[model samples]
Target: MAERTYDVMILGAGASGMMCAAQLNEKSDLSVVVIEGNEKAAKKLKVSGGGKCNITNVNVSASNYLGDEQLIESIFSQFSKEDLLLWLEHRGLKPVLRKEQYYFCPKSSEEIIEILKAASAKSDYKFGEEIISLSKEEHFVLKTKKRKYKAKNVVIATGGKSFGSLGASEIGLELAASLGHESISFLPALAGFTLQKNAFWMKELSGISFEAEVTVAGKTLYEDMLLTHKGLSGPVVLSASLYWSKGEISINFLPKNNLVDLLHNNRRLLSTALPLPKRFTQAFIVHLGIKDRACVDYKNDERALLVSAFHTYHLAPAGTYGFSKAEVCKGGVKTETLNSWTLESNILENLFFAGEVVDITGELGGYNFQWAFSSGVVAAQHIIENNKV
Candidate 1:
């Protein structure tokens, strides 16, 4: 069969690809095609936020992500969180705010996916087509197992390798590398951390969860931290995993109250005096090599030690849960290689990238999805403008 051709060819039918296609379909007359490795569109999106899908966050800024701050700032300036919310509302999909921070679909992820598909109905979708290779001459040529395709412009939105079962791979980074664009290897981000042997006592406290302040890599987060059999997993831990590559993380078990004041002249047992669960406090006390006597019985030095243990419990994580358990992956095609305003490759014209395929990785929230949408719109708008000239 003859190679199929289009004015624009988009890889991956996830958030970025679909959003880009939606913009092109709405604003331009270009013939666009979306090629997806999955059998259907937005497979991973369907499972996001436990199916509701965190579309965006109440608070979004360059500080919430790990990448070139200037690049991120540029993209968001083009399409901010307010712009995204307005767009969704105009399309009859108003996301509801959860926990007063995250914006989630009122019903399910499919609600937003359906809107995107309806908006980009003009674009043809080719599902279950895994791109095998890509090369460029007069136009870009992309080959899959069954056929070949050509396009004047190409958009890479294949995302990162986190959901392997959902067909995630390093193809996006690999393709960029083949085209002479430098990329960083993807690492598991927004995932749980397995503890070192020194923190094995935490494993015994599995299933206990509490609101605490966690500090790592110069970033401090206060959220619920869960002690799991593997080590630690929760909103705060997942966010901390984004900045932490190695070294120690400090957890303040009593973030809201001063341990010294709480223990002041208290007659209760050391474990009982703490605001945390008795079992958890007892285990920690035992791990600290401290007795569980009354708070009044501790010497000044013992009191100081207790205060430090409660306020700055430090531990080094062995590693992350890997891509299988990661909500997203950090690192990809470096932001420096792309036009920040358009997400188009500075090294190669008419080639664009968006979503997790870019080096920017946001903390666990709606930040990642916001970046995907913002970057997609930026790329699409630029493509539309380019076609005019």
Candidate 2:
């Protein structure tokens, strides 16, 4: 049989791959094909955000990501979240804003998927073909378990290794490495942390959640924190995990109230005066090795200790919950090796990268998806301009 060939071939039919193919179809007449390992496309998109995918966020900036800030800023400038919303709105899919920040599909993730499918109607799709190897000579050659294919330009949209069940892998990173590009190994991001032995008492307060502030790696995030069987998991902790590699994280159990002011002249028990969940406060008081007594009975040193314990609780996490529970993965092909404007590899000609595969991971919310879409469009636009007939 004859091997398939195309002007451009995109790996992974996830958010980035589909967006790139859609852009190419809209702006250029190049023969485009999307190759996906899964039987269908957008497997992760279909399940993300509990089926109603978070399309983008109200506030999007380079600060929301853990990567080359300048590169991210460049990409966002070219295709900002506003551009994304306009693109979707023009396609008759208006994402609804949830929690006054995140924009989610009003109905389901399928809404956006269908729009992408329609936009890329001119492109061909080869599903259930897992790429075994990729090599470039005159044209890039890709081999799958089923057959071989070739393309003039290739976009590695193969995403990070987060949802392994959804067919996520480090193939994109591996491919870039084979072509002489440096990359950091992927690690779990936006995931919960397992407690160290000293923090095991937190497990006893499982199911308790409260609004608090978490400070790690010089960044502070205020959001709901959940105490779980493992240790801690919630928006604040997950966001903090993005910056936390090692060392202690500070958690303010009462971020809104001043511990000193709350304790002043109050005669109530420590557990009842702090305005936190009784169970959590009791556990915390016990863990701190301080007797649970009337607030007025505490000495000056004890008051200072209580104040610090409530406002600047510090603990080191053993590790993360691993990729199985991770929403995204950090570290991939370093951004230094790619064109900031186009996401094209400086090391190899005709090679581009987009989405999670490019070493840019966003905190929990819609930032990751926004990055996927923005990077995809930027790469596709460059390809279209270069391949113009």
Output the number of the lDDT-best candidate.
Answer: 1
| Backbone clash pairs in model 1 (N, Cα, C under 3 Å; residues 3+ apart or in different chains), count | 0
Per residue, candidate 2 scores C-alpha lDDT tens digits across 31-84 of 998999999999989998889999999999998999999999999999999999
Cα displacement (Å) at residue 364, model 1:
0.5
Show the lowest summed lDDT stretch of 10 residues, model 1: 1-10
lDDT for every model?
Answer: 0.93, 0.93
Model 1, position 39: C-alpha lDDT score: 93
Give every collision pair in model 2: none
CA error at residue 101 for candidate 1, angstroms: 0.7
**What's the C-alpha lDDT at position 57 in model 1?**
91
lDDT score of model 1?
A: 0.93
Instruction: List the candidates' TM-scores in order.
Output: 0.98, 0.97
